[model samples]
Target: MKLQSTPPIPASDRQSPPAVLTLGPASCDAAILAQLLPVAERFRLNSAHLDPGGLVGWLDRLEALFEAEGRSVPVVVDLQGAKMRIGRFPSIPRLPGRVELVPGDRSERADTIPVPHPGLFRHAAPGDRLFLNDARVELEIERVGDERIGARTVRNGPLEASKGINRAPHPLPFEALSDRDASMIDASIGRPFVEYALSFVRSAQDAGLLRPRLGGHRLIAKLERTEAIAHVREIDAAFDESWLCRGDLGAQAGVGELGPIQRRIATLIPSLRNPCYLAGQVLEHMTHFPEPTRSEVVHLYEVARSGFAGVVLSDETAIGRHVAEVAGFLARAAPEE
Candidate 1:
């Protein structure tokens, strides 16, 4: 596919768009983070993957690292709330022919699987569908018992075990922020220049629930689900900023549908005069190679022409081998403002 041509970058404004870089378990080393910071204008620490204690330690280390550099950077904490995920595995398991997800069963297996999150059973019901591994696999809940759920795979694929799960149909009647997320929000209340990204936001009410608890920090909503897309007008009316989570949205609606949705959102969310970030796989190939693929370069160019506020790096910078090089590539390729 031909990428939309990117506008020329002016000589005066050579810097890239405001990019947000994720720093997590994979890229938590001090030296690596220090090297990445100069290229990254913002740092995002995922609270979903880290426990409260781990989150605290990460915040402390990042703060110390920034202090040593004599630079203050924007820090964003992403909360993993009611989003469903597969139980942890010792490693990323190879795809199985078929996997059955039964609640409370924690044993690793080829056909039958366990869901460790007790909350899934508590919140989800029979007839509701579960999206796993970025929605590559689909399962329909046939029955729900006290602690176990009986689900059959409707759609199956080669899943890299332990990836996050999303619910299909509509929003579940659960809190947007988990107890652990609330604590992180509480602790980060007074910190200067910190931003909170609420993931899987389905409605304006979800954003409203966060306002009281979050003491002066900026709130950025991550619109990653079908429900959020349906309610984009309401959500846009509520939150000042939002992220177009192409990866998650692609899971809900096929990747082919992402472009129009992104463009519609950019037009709808005016408060977010800031560019909406095109996330997930922006430079996925760079995880293995030192250089980005031509297709990835075209994708980046398309993102630039789309006029987003910024492009975010996930595995590309957080765990990839060529973190700085990828950042430099993006900086060089971004359309000049």
Candidate 2:
């Protein structure tokens, strides 16, 4: 769907840091959508969750609503960007034992795990470590085969299906833009208010692979990999904006190292080519409950006071039960400007 020409924002409101809210299946509710729109300066759609058609439907409604008010909120489509993930199978109750990683999106046996990407099978080796479900579970590869790899859990925990997969020290070899990402990008073309974000950016070169396909939309680089942080200056020059995705970064960098990594990014904020936004787990407590923890509230305030241009809420606003309360709290806590 083509967007109508957007109305101008009042100059007085431009200086304040913009709150970018991500939309999920839950946001399809009209009342919930209404509650969310007012508090957010921008909206984000995850291509992994919402298909191209759904994205268009969302933009149609959002654009119409904002146009009626003589204003517009920018829309960002966050591409999956080769994020490796395990496929469907029964949730593992005992994850410590031997498991076989097989091809495709499903496994018939409980002891077997399914991973859809061929790069995993080709690149995996003995003794390699794999982090699953945001690093909640860890696996050590014991054998590699043409069809699958044998692994044993290093960190034992219950595992669910369709969770994120990562290999440290040696990342998987997935393309920078998946076919789904390309399709979503095509869906977003011709809409002036629409922008695109590349996830799991490892370096300026990774951003280079995606920039040409964005059709002139502003590209935001999600600095989730340690490699990306190491080459932040090059990335700063390549992308229009940057986002510090703490959740993934923590998983990749280890929780103990995340703070230092963030401080490193914080130190380089002045040298960055464009605005860098903070993302992931900002209002995590509010995801399952009504109120954010005191620390979370303080964290939001501190992030605003820090050099970040804005913040992005992941599960907090996407699937949280207390959407209105979360939005209100952010508005009260940060009070943009």
Using TM-score as the measure, the top candidate is 2
Task: Estimate, for each residue in 1-337, the C-alpha lDDT of model 1 and write its tens digit.
Answer: 9899999757545544567888765577777777777778788887756667777787788889888998878888887655655655434334454445666424556566667666676778888877777776777888777776677778776564457776665634446556777888876766686888887787888877888887767888788877788777677667767788877778777778888888787666454443456677777888777789888766665565556777777888767877767766765654555
Error of 1 at 82 (Å): 3.0
Model 2, TM vs. native: 0.88
Instruction: Report the poorest 10 consecutive residues by lDDT, candidate 2.
Output: 9-18
Could you give candidate 2's per-residue lDDT for residues 1-337 as a string of tens digits? Answer: 9989988754443333567998876566767777777778798887766678987887888778777666678889888786777777688666748888988887767778898877788778899989887788889999998797999978877777767788886575435567778888888877899988887887777777876787678998898877888888898898899999987777788899988887778888977779999987888898889898989766766766567888898777777777878777755654345
lDDT score at residue 275, model 1, on the 0-100 scale: 41
Backbone clashes in model 1: 3
Give the whole-model CA lDDT for all candidates, comma-separated.
Answer: 0.72, 0.79
Clashes of each: 3, 0
In model 2, the number of clashes is: 0
